[model samples]
Target chain A: MTPLRHVFFVSDGTGITAETLGHTLLTQFEAVEFKTTTLPFVNSPEKARSTLDFINFIAKDAGLRPLIFSTTVNDEVRAILRTADALFLDLFDLMIHTIELELGVASTHAQGRAHGMANQQKYNSRISAMNYAMEHDDGQSTRDLARADVILIAPSRCGKTPTSLYLALQHGLFATNFPLTEDDLEQQKLPSSLRGLENKCFGLTSEPERLSQIRSERRPGSKYASLAQCAYELRQAEQLYRRAQVPFLNSANMSIEEIATMVMQEKNLRKPTF
Target chain B: MTPLRHVFFVSDGTGITAETLGHTLLTQFEAVEFKTTTLPFVNSPEKARSTLDFINFIAKDAGLRPLIFSTTVNDEVRAILRTADALFLDLFDLMIHTIELELGVASTHAQGRAHGMANQQKYNSRISAMNYAMEHDDGQSTRDLARADVILIAPSRCGKTPTSLYLALQHGLFATNFPLTEDDLEQQKLPSSLRGLENKCFGLTSEPERLSQIRSERRPGSKYASLAQCAYELRQAEQLYRRAQVPFLNSANMSIEEIATMVMQEKNLRKPTF
Candidate 1:
């Protein structure tokens, strides 16, 4: 058997993307055993030095080709890693060329210029909120909820939790999402917790078919998973938003990033990370 | 009131970056009111046309400068939006130039090239798993748990959820995370559901100081928020991983992306994106 391959993911700020992309790459080689490590939030040269030292340690005994997935802002730091005995791939390298060609602009060496450019803080916060909501679906989100910067109201599976968390991580916004449960739907009013924050309210609507497809992935064979039921709930949810005078967006084809951005814009919030 | 400055985020697959950047830019102008909308997964010419139509509709009524933040693979499609009356900000246009200069390489324009090069699917899975773990903090992941390509184990506030979600959104891997609760700490055994899946296990550890700082944000004055306690738990968790022979990564400074990438590489996954 081939000795387990080792790969390193180096990041500029949070290391989230490097790890995410790296994990996907690893999944393709189920047969090859490998070892992996990440150096997160490597924002400075000293941190980069530490990362390089660690990489050297990993490469010393490993016989196979070491792979690197990195998003580095510092050329000096990236230069140091170029010397590593490994196959290196970085997203910054891939995207910069395209950006220059399209915009007819030269590249700048400003650090953190691209850092918050993607709304990372809001993205992280919303991701956190989504994870929090999913784990805490016991109806506890209603109380002590002032920390929530925005509350998303939508029927089941309209991309609520994911959007919320995206807002949190990308903007440092505390986002909370409440399902317009059947009772809220029947009553056709916003959730009781969201009543006073109408100015901060935004809605996500999706085509019933799309919503059904996503729901099917988690709860197949349930009424919620059926196209008909999904359609009904979506329609009810849309009506609720309309009656409640809340601004809404259709998430039928939007990515989580897009959803969070739209909500932030609608709420007129300027996120910290981007 | 100044007409809300309108910003449109158009993306190739998921309009995440476009929207996120757009949201951040809106924040720069404190005096101006702003409205934002995200067009997600707009990877085709037809979608671009529809997006243009929407822009036209908004322009007719809003009479404001529309900022377009776009991420596109097809140059032709991206060009269609150039006619918009608003200040257009294409995400690819901004970053590509910088990336090429940094890497000293011209990129090839191959279809689906971006997906494989960046390895987004794996990150998506990690994000999904992180989201699942956050919602299911009671120490249970939903069905399809076995599908996780990699599982993360860490104590509370150890950056497990963010790392996992980053993996999911970016990489599309089936990543699941389990928190090392007090019970697990005392028992020093894997979760009952995770016994047979040891081959897929990876651990995230952090310096006690870092963990304490993170937790302090969530709970200000409590025993659980004590730095001393955090240090003890981290030590105990390290011992547990050592005894189980589960390889671990210290996330004291790693970004979420880096951690996911390391896990992917360690697993020896073949393709960049599954």
Candidate 2:
């Protein structure tokens, strides 16, 4: 068994930048076992001291020096964190310096600016998109299907809701998902409400075995979770895609982020350019 | 005013990692103007060539070498991206290699693995959390507030929804949010559904000016969106927080990411440990 290593993502604010960059780097090293924790909003010397203590404790417990990925922008807070008995890595210093030199400007060294609230318009649009994604999820509100940037069509548990929500959160895209019911699959047609909006549609299809496994978690031992049913639904849905000339992708192997962005790229070509 | 420079977040998958890291880096250079675009799922050599073309076009139009921050893991795709008429930086290679040596393992060099479907449990939990957040949004369903990891309370448009969703999507945290309505503010008490769930409650307060500005966009010129109304609501909400002893953050300056993580850190201290 691979030795379990404790990893910490430390930041002065959300810790998202640290976590995302750290996780991406960590994903490459598949042989090691990494149990990760995030310590966010560590703005003060006191908080940094406690975080350092936490890292030390975890390192001692695991008999390994914890790997601390930090983006503590504050110099004073960062000084306290540097005292931990671990292999510390600063995520921002070197890159920010290079960018600073390129632009011939000094950085503000402010906290929470990475994802802070400055532009009200961008923020409001993101919230509105989130509400829109939920309101129209699973074919609930097809009334304003025309207004959606992209309408995701997929069978139950085929990753429509999460993908739609991801698009809304990340891109501020008004993405709505419609689940293809068994009847629609059997009829080999899109839903009545989505008929005219076919141009703004994207389809998500997945493997039968994967679909079966996903469905089993929700409705154990039911026909809905059966392999045969999933195969039938996926086949019929793909046929509908081909007939309607709508582009689709297999989402069984894809993440919500992957599917959301890929859908947008496809949609971008067909939809009007901004 | 600073001259506009074209910026590109190029990635082999969702482009989220590139966009996020690039955005964080850009935030430090506050004085610069960056017109950024994301090029996602550029896995194929042809796609890479086309992305380079887009970068070149932006450079030609803007008369400045575009800054391209890429997380393209594929070597061939990366080579094509590097050939663009711009300054290019790889986001993951050096760090992943250093860690790979530390672990004495080779990287998979897989595309989409950063946010891919390697862990089924984590993916399902994220979806479950999204559903929980949606159901519990604005006190819509509070029958099982006990199940939530954190219940965010705030006045309308104070950013509870986006923060809740971001936590769910990123952390797989079951975060529910409730709007501290005018009725609750006037009564100066927690809502009936949230009374016993005080332990799980976290509050969000914002600057009255920012609140008014946010509200005015949604309900232009209405009394609810007026400065007096915003001031009164924020004052009452803060008093309620003091009475309930609920920990709160002024979200006027923080981003949704910052607010979510800070709320989690506060909730982490009070909630049970794993």
Candidate 3:
């Protein structure tokens, strides 16, 4: 049996970037089991040394060399962390050096700039986008449908709300979602509020079984959660999407991230620049 | 003046991981300006070749090498992209190779696994947490506050809502936020509903000037948006936090990510494991 390998994501900031990249890399090695930990806000040499000690202790306890993925930008703290007895992958140091050589410029090596509120304008806009999404969620307010970058249309519980919130919070896009009611689906047309916004409308459909299962968790044993009703609603929603020329995707097997990415690409929505 | 460098994030999936890490790396070089683009869903060799052509064209047009940060896991596609006329940084290839050697096992080299829905249970919980956050936003409903992993409290416009949603969506934590009302501040006590949940509570406070500025955008030329009102409210909230012994932070300058990470750490909230 393969032993569980220990991995550490160490960063001077929130360590989210290191953890994100590290998780993606670890997912590639499916045969190996990994126990991962994140050490964030390790901005000082003292903190770095203690983190190193903790990592070494874990290595000794696990009887394996732990893999360390670090993004610490402070020179002194990074130097301290580099002395650990493991495969220390310095994410920032090597890449920053290469980019510096290529650009003929030296790096500032500043810490906490990656996720800090450095650009107030962009930060404020991101918050505003989140507000926009919350206000417009589930067709709550169609008063400003014209302001939406993309409007997701789907039957209830087909994964519209999460995708809308993800787009707004992650990319600062003005996204909104609307649930297609039985009347709209039976008519096989876009909702009245989305009449002229077909260009910005994206539809999501799910497998009948999946939709029924999700709805069952909300309202058990109801016709709304029945497989027959779900299948009918999805079939009608797809027909409406085709008639309206709205791009759509099946959310049965896709994550919200994947769904959001495809919607953004299909609608030519650009992520807001900081 | 520094010449602008073009950077591309190429991936077989959503390319969010590539863009996120690449953005962090580029932020270290404060002197250089970057014009970045993301090419997501590049899962084929044909797509890789076309992406290479695009990167090379930009390199030629700019008279400088364009930087390519890629997370494509397919061998054929990655090989084709490696031939681009730029500084090609393959995020997965080198790290996976090293990890494979360390573990003495071959990587699956699977495409689209980074952000795919490989784990349905975790995905469902994340969606549930998002719904919980939305239901409990701004103290909208406290019916299930007992199930929340953390509760964030602050006066209006102190950034409680966005932080709560981010905590739920990103970390899969059941998070709820309450906007401290004038009555609660005047009484200098926790809300009646939050009386027994002090251990699970975290307070957020913002600078008076910043709070007033944020409120001014929402309700211009109103007493609620006045600097004096903002100062008084913040002071009362902080005192309430101290008296109730709820851990808190000043959110005036911190990004939502920073604030979320700090709250998680302080509250000892472990990110849900898949």
Best by TM-score: 3
What is the per-residue lDDT of model 3 for residues A27-138, given as tens digits with 9 covering 90 to 100? Answer: 8777777888888999999999899899988888988899988889998998998888788887876587787888898888888888889789888988999999999999
lDDT of 1: 0.65
Tens-digit per-residue lDDT, A129-188, candidate 2 = 888998898988867778899999989988998888988887788989998998888888
| Tens digits of lDDT, candidate 1, A7-78 | 786776545456544543344344455576666567777777777777877778775557787767677878
Which tens-of-lDDT digit does each residue in B173-262 have in candidate 1?
556688887888789987778888888788889998877877886788777879888988898899989989888989775545456656
Using lDDT, give the best candidate's number: 3
Runs in model 1 deviating more than 4 A are: A1-139, A213-227, B1-138, B141-145, B181-188, B216-221, B269-271
Error of 3 at A68 (Å): 1.2
**Candidate 3 deviant stretches above 4 angstroms:** A272-274, B272-274
Error of 1 at A268 (Å): 2.3
- Which of the predicted structures, 1 or 3, would earn the higher lDDT when compared with the native? 3
Q: Model 1 TM-score?
A: 0.62
Measured by DockQ, the strongest candidate is 3
On the 0 to 100 scale, the lDDT of residue A132 in model 1 is 57
Check candidate 2 and list the clashing pairs: none
Cα lDDT listed for each candidate: 0.65, 0.82, 0.90
